[model samples]
Target chain A: MRGGSWRQSSLTGIGVLFGVTLAGLLLLPFFALAISTPASDLLEGATHPLFASALLLSLRTTLTSLSITVVLGTPLAWWLASSSSKTARVIEVLVGLPIVIPPAVVGVALLQTFGREGLLGPALGSVGIALPFTEISVVLAQIVVSAPFFVKAGASAFREVRPDMLIVARTLGASPPVAFFRVALPIALPGLLVGASLAWARALGEFGATLLFAGNMPGRTQTMPLAIFYALESDVRLAIVFSLVLAAVGMLLLVALRFLPALRNFMRGGNA
Target chain B: MTSWQVIVRARRGELDLDVTFEGDEQPIALVGPNGSGKTSVLRAIAGVLDLRDARITVGDTVLEDTSAGVRVPIEERRIGYVPQGFGLFPHLTVLENVEFGLSTGKNPLQSEERSRRALQMLSELNCASLSERSVKHLSGGEKQRIALARSLVLEPAFLLLDEPLAALDATLRRTLRQFLAERLRLFQGPSITVTHDVRDVAALGAQIVALENGRIVQQGPLSLIQQSPATEFLAEFVGAD
Candidate 1:
């Protein structure tokens, strides 16, 4: 165990070399982006007429989806964490099923459910509310694909909270609702935030589902990822620039998660 | 009038705790080894966990009744609990923690009155200086005092303390025990304290209830139990110096 030949593991050395090489390979895309494109080119692409509209649409839909996710997912995650009923377990598994399934399959599933000839289509058509290819469909696709990220993360966060603490809060004259809002929510909020951020990022990057279910319509359903794809066919420079911007946004999400109180406490060790 | 009668028959496969007791104005000391169901009894009394067969009455109120389908919720039960090591709310300051009970009460006080009463309780506990300090920053002794102040501020029907001194070292435990004993004596209602230390019973002057293997092997005054042990386990447990 000391500084000796026996302590120097050949297996560990080989494992470390493989890990570094893989890590460097993963970083190659980012390196290529920096190597080929100047920063000013990304600015030029940002000024493109299609870029502004697509970015706007992406921001609007992602924001709406994130709001919807937090509102619905908070209670959903809480119920899942605390409830021991068989139905709750079933619902938890169903909600998590989306995360494991491919986004394109999710696209087809949504299409089969909401398309004009699909499951709820006749009823929805009778009401004259078409979902497919509409902006609302874009938001729906994001929600289907992204809300699970928040719910799963939030449920895990809620589980991390000590049941004893909640019981103690109740003994201190806090009603179940009051204790939930005051004690449990505050304690689990950081995890919830992380979950929300993950959902938002997922919603922003959503591609196959949006393309299949919502369709790429300029100034309506086209998000940043869609914009990048469209630009790739018409203009390669703008495509690369759009990609750089998307990568920056993803990095921004990571930085934002680090600043949250929950993650900060986690990084500093289990003092909380 | 605050006397309570508790009859619990709880069986979780192998773990069984069938206990029956009645007391008024006396601090009941729950004594046993690690797996003796002492914590379970406290949880049952606090109304957080209901036994399979239980009828617990405090004063005139029936907190739990298996046959009658009557079970008061934990908040409405009005029982105070100081958990093992006193898990104080790390988010709130001393005064805020004390005020939390009042803030969430059925009929909460005006903001000024809540703060006034919180500070008053802190003064009584000689911890007014810690009213602004966060619970996370306090030492073990300070946290214990603040926890007591938090529970007492609620004016609960009775206090259920789970190993209050178990987290402290010997010297600190000795000091805090004397403080707790004096404070409990001055309090108006009954209390229950779980402990493994025989000296704790001797110091607190509480009636002893010895539990082993999820059953009450002995229950009486410490002097009585010391003279006549109910079983071999109680003999060694209670009669020890």
Candidate 2:
């Protein structure tokens, strides 16, 4: 069992070669981004007003969208996880539609719902509120595009919590809400954290929806992705810096997701 | 002694459960083959499982009556349940799990009272040393004791235990069976225990309620059931002709 025949070993060697090739090809650009850029160019781009504004806007919008998603999605996830109704199944599919649909399509849908002269045009106008081409629109676009990740992950996580646990909690004199908060939520927190990080990353890189719905306005709705789009046409080095920054944030989230389970186990003094 | 009457009609998956039984202060042992709806009956009495129709009454108080549209919520039912596999809260310390019911019911105790009561319950179970440990770290028997203590701390009017010793090894199961039998003897209120072991019924000296495919085939003392086992499962359980 320790060693295979020569032919079997050669087959495994070939499989390894194929896997390494694909991985190297996928990672080549990141290495290029890190090594090919000049230090002076990176520093200059980092200090630029456009870079700073775009970075700030991306952070602010993604955080806002992430918080909103968690607040709204937790209860929805719990309900969907607990209910065995056909309506819940339908709603689950509808909630997950945004993840599969293109971001540009999502932008169009948001415009149709919130834009002036759209479906809710008169209602919004009566209230003196216009959502299109605003910072709020940027947040809306991010939420529309990113919320599905959180909801999907959260529902699955809540499902993993044993139904018997909730029943016992309720029978132990905790109300339904108390059972969820004390029993289900803590058990599902790790998965929810991963979902939130993914949602934040998706919101941070929102380009199509923000561009079409919020418009690429400097110091307002021009997020890092949009900045990169414009930066690419004028200065490639500036675009590389923006790409590096976005990639770095994404890498950090991936790294966190990788270690989160181990961290949770350590916090729990290792699983029994 | 106050009498408890439980009548439940519910359908879950393939099980069409419609059973009725009444008992005084003595514990009732609910035994059946796999998938015979014993756990569902306990869940129904506890008001955790929604029933098509039910009339659950303990002495003078009605816990559930579908015809009257009076169904007490699970938290207000004053029923303690120990589900199969113990169902301990994985995130809380053992003491915190015990304190949960006392700290957040209809009439919550103050912080000090809650801690004292939880500690007292743990000590009574001989698990005071496990107070600060996470529930995830306890052994199967320890988890069972902590789970029982957690429920008992609420001072429930009724208790429902579902296969409390099913997860333990044979030796541990035997030990906990004796421990549980003693505890049940001391408990003052009506309780139902779901089990497959005939030894459990004989040890607890409980009224027997044998279910088969969601229907109660026998309900009486174990001696009567021993005279004529109703189903093949029960015959195998009691090893009788």
Candidate 3:
């Protein structure tokens, strides 16, 4: 019995060591960044007007992109969840390709689709609509890269919902939209929010695609991440400040996500 | 009075199902072993499954008749279905789960009254105290009651319950079966309950339709079917040991 207890203790010790090491590797950078920066520097960074404007523009674009993603991706996700058709699977794979392809390749693809000399350009021009090198272009770029995240997450979330629940709702006399909003959406909300947050964060920090397609025009197209790039060239302190602001906002969202009721209930359910 | 004559044919994997049944103002229990196409019969009636040749009639209404090419959407069918596994909306509270079927009306009180009626049904089942709890938090027995309340609140012309107690524990199963029988007695309209348990037939005293593989092998009063089971499978299924 003593030997068995010793074996169990040693096994537990090894497991704890492995878990701690993995956590340390993942969290070390953020801790180091925070510890190395003086509180005074962080405070100074927080007060800059340029930082504020970049922050505002980042927020605006991220929100707009997130809205557009939810609007377009939700119905598509629902369809993908409910459909057993081979064609729907093909469409699902096509939507997922954006996430798999490198961001730089996505930039190139977007330019090819919407750039001045590209496909749909002449038609848009005929309608007097220009897409590249503007705030709208920044939103478009973010949507191109980030929308897939929402779609993928939303689809999986919807798929996790049992068809029986939806059937019960319909039998109870709920229309398709009513059943979706009441039953499917609420059940899928936690995942949808997590996906939205991840996509929003990705869009806010997007650099390669924005630089390639939207161009780095300050006050018009330059978001915080782009501003950080330019500020690093001109002033290192300003870049650090921008980075600090971005980190703070990201942390705030992560913290706020915990407060979501659906997530709370989901966690309380313990793997239900 | 509502009446139904349903015939559907569907092939799924190794199972080929061709079933025909007629009922009016009586509860029919489809009792069979696992994978005997009992649930498939219910699904076909609910219009959740497409059949090559299906002819379903509720009263004078022709819900589906593939011979004449008429298929009504599930939403407009006026049939309440409680699928196996409770199928409670995990995100909604018990009251909300029960209220879901009633919330579609233009008058809010129509929904409120329906919800109240649902609560009363839950109370009758001794689950009213769990009204504020999320369906996900409810015990399996509680979820079953909520699923039943949700279905019955619609006041549908035809009710279908597919293995309603299959997900519960053995202890809960026996108790809920009794409660279910009592509830079914109160429902004046036609209902079809599918189950694998022979005890359900004895407890409910329902008209038994015994199925094997994908066909109805024997069907009649529970006493008649119990005493003289037609097939060897039926003899084994009715617990003739």
Candidate 4:
């Protein structure tokens, strides 16, 4: 009994030690940054014109990319989740490629596809359009790198929906589109919201692709992350402050997400 | 009156079902052991399932004639389907769930009238008090009532209820079975209900069809089927042995 009890307690002790160690490891960098940078500096850097525009530009482009992804990804997600076809599986993988590929590879691919003398460049030129090194390119780059995450998460959300409910909706006189919008979309909103948040965060922090595809132009393509990179080269304190501000914004959004009652209920029910 | 006339030939997994029944506005009870394709029969009529050699007609209109390549889509087919799980919209209030059927683009009723009609249906079912409640907050019996109210508000040409009260507690099942029979009388169309209980047959059915091994073993009025069991399975099913 003594040996057994000692072994059991020792195993539990080891588990606790590992758990606390992992938690401390995860929080160490954040803790260090918080103590190193004063809150007053964070507030000041957040409001400065250069940092402020970058923050505004990041929010604008990410929100735009997220909106575009939601509008396009929802149907794609529903189809991927519901279909039993091999072709659907192939399409899902194609759509999901960005999540596995290096962001730099995606940037190079995007530039090749849309840059001057690239595949669609001649066609775009005929219509008097240039896409590279602009805010549009920034949004496009973010989308190319981040849409796969949204699609993957969105597909998972759609998978949780019961197909029978949609069938019942159809029998209640709702056509396929009507049933999808009025029934499926509402029930899957929480999952879709989670997906949107993930995609939004990913788009907000995108660096490698935007740097390659959308050259970091201040007041345009230069987002918060890009701003932090440039700030670090010239002034270490400025970079630290900007990084703290971005982390704070992200934390605030995550806190707000938990408080949304509908999502909370859906998530709770889902677990049950 | 809208009648459910379907000759369904289907193969689900290993179960090969070839069953035909044609009748008027009387609730038909499909009683059988599990895996007898009872639910498949109801699903076939609801157009939520694809069946080989199925000829489904509502009155004279051919809803699905697989031979002639005529299959009506689910929305166009006027079927009120209550799935096995009740399939209520969890995110919606009971009133909104009921209002959903009436607010369809194909529904002629305006938004105001649709709301009024949905409320009246809820009130009739004694579920008006629960109308503002989210469906996730509802008890099984309450959700069942709301589901029925939602289905009935459509004034559907036919009702397809898959083991309606199976999810409820025994006490609630008995109460809701009687409640369903009373409510179904107001519906002009016949309902095809799938059940494993003989009491469900007595409370909710005017006609009963016994299925075994994916085929109808016997069918008639509930009393007739119960009194004169056609096979050992029928006798066992109706508790006559």
TM-score winner = 2
Query: Considering summed lDDT, which 10 consecutive residues are worst modelled in model 4 chain A?
Result: A263-272
Best by DockQ: 2
Q: What is the lDDT of residue A21 in candidate 2?
A: 99
Model 4: residue B182 alpha-carbon error in angstroms = 2.9
Ranking by TM-score: 2, 1, 3, 4
Instruction: Give the alpha carbon lDDT tens digit for every residue of B1-241 in model 4.
Output: 6665889998888899999988899888888888988888888888877788999998878889998999999888888899998999887788889998777755457878988999999999998988777788788999899999999988788888998989999888878888988888877587888887888777766688888889998899877876889987778878832
Give lDDT: candidate 2, residue B106: 68
TM-score for chain A of every candidate model? 0.90, 0.93, 0.85, 0.89
- For residues B1-241, what per-residue lDDT tens digits would candidate 3 score against the true structure? 6778989889867789988888887778998778889888888888888798889999998989997889987877878898888888876778877877677634335766866887887887788888878777678888888888887767787889998998989889989999898888887778899977778877877788887888888889877877899988778778642
Model 4: DockQ score? 0.53
The better candidate by TM-score, 1 or 2, is 2
Model 1 spans > 4 angstroms off: A1-20, A38-43, A84-94, A262-272, B9-17, B33-35, B51-53, B65-70, B212-214, B239-241
The DockQ assigned to candidate 1 is: 0.49
Per-model TM-score, in order, reads 0.88, 0.93, 0.88, 0.87
The deviation in Å at residue A172 for candidate 2 is: 1.3
Q: How is the predicted docking of candidate 3 categorized under the CAPRI scheme? A: medium
Candidate 3: what lDDT? Answer: 0.83
Cα error, residue B41 of model 4, in Å, equals 2.5
Clashing pairs in 4: none
lDDT of 2 by residue, A1-272 (tens): 54568779999999999999999999998998899888999999888878988999888888999899999989999888889999999999999888899999888888989999789967998999999999999999999899899999999999889999999888888898888888899989988998898899999999998998999998988999999999999888889999999999989989999999888879876644
